[model samples]
Target: MDGRAFLASLRTTAVTRVEAGERVAQVSRNMGVSRSSVYEWLRQARSEPQKLQASPLQGRPSALSPDGLHDLATALLAGPESAGLTGRLWTRELVNELVSRDHGVSLTLTSIGRLLRSLGLWPRHSLVTWPDGSARLWKQRYAYIKEKAREQDALLMRGGLVDVGALLPRSSLPAAPFGFHLAYALIPGGPLLFRAYSGPANAATFLDFATGLVAETGRATCLITAPHPVFDLDECARGLAGLPLTVWVRSDGDARALRPAPAPATASAPDLRPAVLGGPSTGLWTMDRLAGHLSALFGHPVSTGEAEVLLSAQNLWPEGPLPPVLPPGSPAVGRWCHDVLPLFQAEAGPGAAVRFVQEVPLPGGRTLLLAVSPDQERRFAWYEEARYQGRMRATTLADFTRRLRQDLAEPLCLVVTDDSGWRSRDLDATATTVGDAFFCTWADGCGERVWRIPERDPVQALCRRHFHQGRGPAPAGTASLEMEHPPRGPVGTADRQVRIAAAREHARRQPLSAGGRLRELVLAGPPALLTTRTLTALLSRAYGRPVDADRAVAVLRDEGLWPEEFPSVEPGPWEHETLPLYLAHAGAGAAVRFVAEARLGGDLSLLVALDRAGETRFAWYPQARYRGRMRATTLVSFAGLLLDDANGPLCLVAADEAGWKSKELAAALARRPVLVVAAGVPYLCAWPAGCGNRAVMGDQCRTHARRSRRLAVHRARSGPLLDAVRAASAELAVARA
Candidate 1:
């Protein structure tokens, strides 16, 4: 009964009992109601307003009025907070509370709930909620989805189907909790078709199924699928020529239509409480709907339910996960389509009018009807026995019938060359040994050779079980035969090296000049840029040809194969200007200190050492200034600041600093002339007579001191100047000795 009528009946009973002066418990028992029920009814009667006894409030809205109730329900469903409420989700209790506090109208908790139920507003599990703001981002970030759909549609118009697979939320599938996917494709004649899979899905597997379809049917406008690094899209640009791409977006129900009513409120419905109300992306269902709308625009019935099934089937089937293993697109599934379509065509061969069926697993672990051929029942009866005896390897009923068709095409008949013994009999047919075995099974229920067969001839029972009683041409010869082997070349180091060298030479001749090709012969990637250490690793396995690091380095250098300049630098106080310092003193002195410092650091002065023989030149320079000021100085001082080494003259080359790297340093060094540094010391000449006569002075300073010493005695003045010169000369001689 309606809640109001039930309440009114209870009130009448409660009043009658009270007027009769009856006890509450006795009255409750007589009325077949609980004491609480009776008490509640009495309470309702006492709390009733004078509306029944007098005039009702004019134009006052009713708490349970159809219009007001619908408004409240609609607002709560949209989002509770949108109705000026505190929470995003509405609980029945919360809804009741809001209604009772209406200021002018009030309702009982029971009445509020009854009103909602009457208005078809019962509570339900929340639908899958995608990121709140994804819808906005989709148009910008997911334009690819539309582009792919359009391409797919265009292909379908020309008689093609684009196969695709995707993982969608359970709400989208509404079939299983997890592992379920959506497999879909576009057909020229109509909209998309779909199936489901409850397992792992990969690009290769998806492509394998596509290949089957293509090989079966020669009908495809274009292939389309969600873009994946491995599947729909190629990892390299070279693999993308003449290819199609797809886009998969996460969204809720179609953005264009109403979603299914929230799942019925029950223990079975899972709670889907989102952590945030409005976030980055909208729900997957919404995106799915948007995808559907796009698909629909292309004259395809873009359906959410169909999309879910399509993705699921691709994942469940074998070979669907192994994408690109066949071809870039689903050429395999396409092949399957090509093969099957012909068999069903009007011009198909005789006995080709059989039915086809597929056995597929349901989402809830149940096996159910998927597809069936008109002749499936008759077809199954003929092949079921052979399938049971292990003569056929068909797992499903439909598969069994397919195997039977193959058998029927080539029946295991006894070919009699001379019909002499009981020509009317269908038995004792003459044929080859293996063919005879199969013919005997057709006539005698099983091949007859157990007792007469020799033990060494393993084909005795194997031929009967594997090749007998099936449709196919018989083998040409007996089983006893030797296996043929492919030819092999002489195995030795010299031969392998010859092959490798030839391969390398061929690679070098290629127009691209890609180092990767040469490296692939020895290792992988570019080989020319490899250091001696890396090169040694590639040659380590060559027989009898041991590699000495020093010898290898020299050999490569002599051949101009190894980098002439090691791209390394020493730690030095001389900054980027280290190269110029070394250039300033380009004679013999550059050898002793340059060798020790460069080895201790990295090969920093490579450029300076290259031009160190005779020319006095400098190139490397540090050009940055502090504020508006420029501290111009000798190259040596500038080198000291740029490099880590303190005592050495600047080299025209800046080696990579031991602890620092700068493009500026490299760019500055690149402008210099090449120089070589030797690892030896020069013979010392006699000490000069001035500047305290330090014998082993650097080249630039040594010459300056010798000139100054020669002129010092002659340039002296007569009195104190001459006396002072004599004293300085005496000190210089003493310091030198």
Candidate 2:
């Protein structure tokens, strides 16, 4: 018997003997076990006799030995390419081949799957590819911080600043018109020290709070704070000189570790009982009573403004009518509708144009200026202008107005804008010089409408919605207003051509890197599929590295490929009618096409094709079974299935690596024009004269390009550590640059 069964048999025998009225001591002596063990066994037998039963033996031994399994795991970690596999993904067939080749164990695909599962390995779908050493670096940093905190017996605290205006009553907000900044330091499971200050949150306020905290605690404080401009490290170090304090700037990975735990519920100090504060004869709290209560609680003379802020923080409202909650910009909107809109309407006469101007802030310090006429035709034009480094200047508005004037041929134009920045004296001077009337009005709650234009034309709403969705072209009905260029004549076309040439020259000078390729694609046109995921996949394939979606977007902005603005519209639930309309459009055989491509990897096959409209479409399904073998359907069959109801002749393109070589499928498609073309494999690396491995970075294979990148990061991180170590050993001062 196995060792487990033998032990179980002994336990069962001991329990039987003990239950038969024999002394526990005698049973233990006979069995050579302790009396306590016999007694425990007897008790277990009385409760659950099945507890003494032995567990069943394991199933038959695995086909591969333990050492072979270990080697298999190591191979998996090294990736499929390391084992001479074609693709990066690990499939059952690949693992079976790996085991048969390396371990000399020929296993079935099913058996290989079982073995992989036993080793705690499973197939996962992830678009993000994390760096190799980032997790290890994060763990090391966390361990170092924890060790230092433990050695110094320091209180690990996190500091934050909150705007008091968010919690204060609207009536009291004017006392600190810009809102009072409340700087707070929180000790996990300890006291919370906070102070209210005026003006913007800056380094001086943070330093003052930290200094006071150090003075109060008289203990070592390790503060974890976000890397905001308010926490300038050099300024903080100088301001907190000779204090037992250390500041750590938090990184994205360390957010969870630096998050403060909830403090204990038990009160650490005397509670300020609000009921004990007697009110006036009317039983209402006056400002004096509230201020006096706060003064006593904080042990300092509290002003009325401070008391109001404190009352709001504690959610203590005086007995009175509740303040009405109005939507943002409502008052301004009301004023504009009552007073300013009429003046613009009166100015808009025959041959005269009234354009509602809207300014949208975009990524990368740019602004989009849109001017749409209020008339039924909805004549609109937009201009993109770069902003100054810090703020929007008058020159940007002037340039946009100039461009608008060149586009619209109307002699007299009245421009209505909601942007307060248009009220600048410089902008007014420019408006007077251009002879364009500028009227600044208040925007509506949605910010898309100053006057209710959507109610007049439903097409305006649809266009705005499509632009905000950032999906397809503006719905079928909407059209851009075309106008003849002003008598400036041939200059416009020449200027545009010159600009295009300049852009081409700039692109030519740019190196053929991932960013350069992305810029080129964007310059060609705004991609039909502009989603982050799609861009990430495209860039990853082009660059031969794991590119994150967010990183792709950031690159677009940095390369000036991103648009200055897109319409902002809140998404609504999909209407029931949308699906039917989409299917009918596709069924008409005018909007979509059928293209078949061979599978790249996995059980599923992918078919990517471009439609007649030049928009990319993808269709995928499990590889079809035909005569006991996997085969894709003929192009004729797929076209008929997709466009069965259409009356027109269907156009089908069959592009595959090998599957479409059948003469029968070719003959079927021969009734019409057939073009057979060979396409390169897009999945492989594009690097010239390099190993055609899977690309994980930009256009280059990971094996050939990522090694240098990893080394560069390692050197950058290790340089500081090496310098500190050498300086400490030689007793030399290390100057930081």
Candidate 3:
């Protein structure tokens, strides 16, 4: 029953009980009204005799006539939205507006209230529930994206459906609280809220969601419906300033009559930051993305402003943007020359130098001839059990030591091929003494073996000296093995690192330059390795002397290795600036192909060979950079050499800094504009037309410095016509009388 009918029945029961001699408390219980209320009604009945009667406010005329009242009740029952209101809730003002529109009766909110009381209808703010069909529509929208993305290479296209829902119960009145929002995004991970945000959702929630959608998906689209009044999508579209996000607001329940969302206010910054919102470039409580995440997590909508407040209060990023991560893949130590520059530690291949192959430097003028060969067992294998089957070599210790001692004389050792299945026959005897020869069982990776002969006992070395030797393919039917000798000379971890760099340096300077042609070779590489250390290391290894690394950088930059506009992107783990991992693992031929196909722009240019050095002087203006020059190097080294005309001419010459350091090369260096004649590394120097950009002359620098020091000399002057002289590191600034 309505409030009026219920009140009337209570009055009737209370009056009847009072007349029947029942007490006020008993009457109150019977009538379900307070005792004072029953007493007041009984007194009114005794005095006026008609006050307890319920006749619907008899004698007073209702502002909304019975017909108007009936129409208002009908309109409210049909919902405010049906009667042309913003939302589904009812209010006195909304009822007033409804009466005027549907019944042609202008009534005040106060009069509407009285009419509502008479018709068993009381005003209330309706509870907010998940919008009808919103979730299903949201899912369907995402499904559509997935399907369309398949045709579009799994990319999120612009102008797709976006749905956001957020629930915020009012602390004061949760039954019908004032907070509810929609989750907004077509992406799978929905908008999320900052942790510990229990307060009501607001504009910030939606803002946060929208911002994330624009950034992550690069989508500019939205869907609007009439059920929610606060979300004015056309007005909301202004947030995505730089993106192409388009907002579509549903109008009149018709598909074609939709209103387009408004454009953003101004242009936004470029999307140069990382993919995630909480990256270092982004704020701790980046409102837009936070809203999106929270909405998605809570299965409700979160606004950008709501998200911002929560985030601002607490820290979202305890650390900076996460390091690049990749899926786990492992087949440890396969090729020995792959990632981490493997061939450096233990050398056992053909053509390796005698020094590199030896187990250690024999004490005081002692020498040992060691055999070197390749492990063809792992020649075609990359990693793990797949390639490890045939790498083991079985041999008894006693038998091997007998052959070594027989072949070599006193103070000589034999490093053999015993990578696998080599162990001491008896553990009790650590060192086997046989006829003044000490034999210790030792093995290394890639099927390499070693036998040590210490002429003197109690070797004072803690660990073995790490060395690599051997080179070139073996003769018919033989493995290309180098020195696989083990010794007692200790090599620490730091020393190992330094030696690894040195090994790569040796290979790059020697083997990489060993190709047939020099002048026509073009070295196309990434700009990342055009630095001082790498170039100096190259020349030093090639020339076998210390070349100033800084001078090398200056020369190569003159040779056109300086990238004008360097592009940067966050690299994944096991990655480098100039080279892709796939290319890094591939052979030299594959690398050449990759660089040729790569449409590099900005500073990432191919090193071109400009001129071949003449017998009398360095090549007259080395002005060309190419890609064919890169050989026998890891692709991720960010360098390549080429000799193709497909790209524009790059004036860069690659040469050993030592070779180009003569005084005669200066004449050639003075000729070229935008000249890049690198002393050590290919495509790593720039000696432009003027001295405005520094040029590093390898050997010529010392000669020039001596000359400059002489030219810099000047006559001394008596200070203030008295007794001091000057001209050390200063100029005269002479004033003539």
Top candidate by TM-score: 2
Worst 10 residues of 2 by lDDT: 440-449
Error of 3 at 223 (Å): 11
Residue 132 miss distance in model 2 (angstroms): 17
For residues 412-483, could you state the per-residue lDDT of candidate 1 as single tens digits?
A: 212111122212233232211111111111111121122232234322322233233233433432111111
Worst 10-residue stretch by lDDT in candidate 1?
A: 167-176
Query: Against the unseen true structure, what C-alpha lDDT does each candidate score?
Result: 0.32, 0.44, 0.32
* lDDT digits (tens) for residues 1-737 of candidate 3: 22344355557656776788887764553333467887788888889767676556568554654335434544544455567775434456667677777667787766765665454333132222223445556666656545544554443422222221111100111121111122323322432211111112232333444454445444434333233322332223334333344333333322121332332221331231122232222212223544576677556675654443333233321111111111001111110112121121112222222110111112232222122111100000011121134432223333333433343344222222232333434421122111111111111111111233223322211112211221221124221111112111243322222222223332223222221111112242322222234556655533333459555444334333333442222233323332232333232323112112111333233422322221111111122223532222222221222212213222333332323333434344343221334322211123222233222443233345455556555322334343334552234554431
lDDT of 3 at 668: 42
Backbone clashes in each candidate structure, one number apiece? 114, 11, 113
Top lDDT prediction, candidate number: 2
Off by over 4 Å in 1: 1-290, 295-529, 532-580, 583-672, 679-737
> Which candidate, 2 or 3, would have the higher TM-score against the true structure?
2
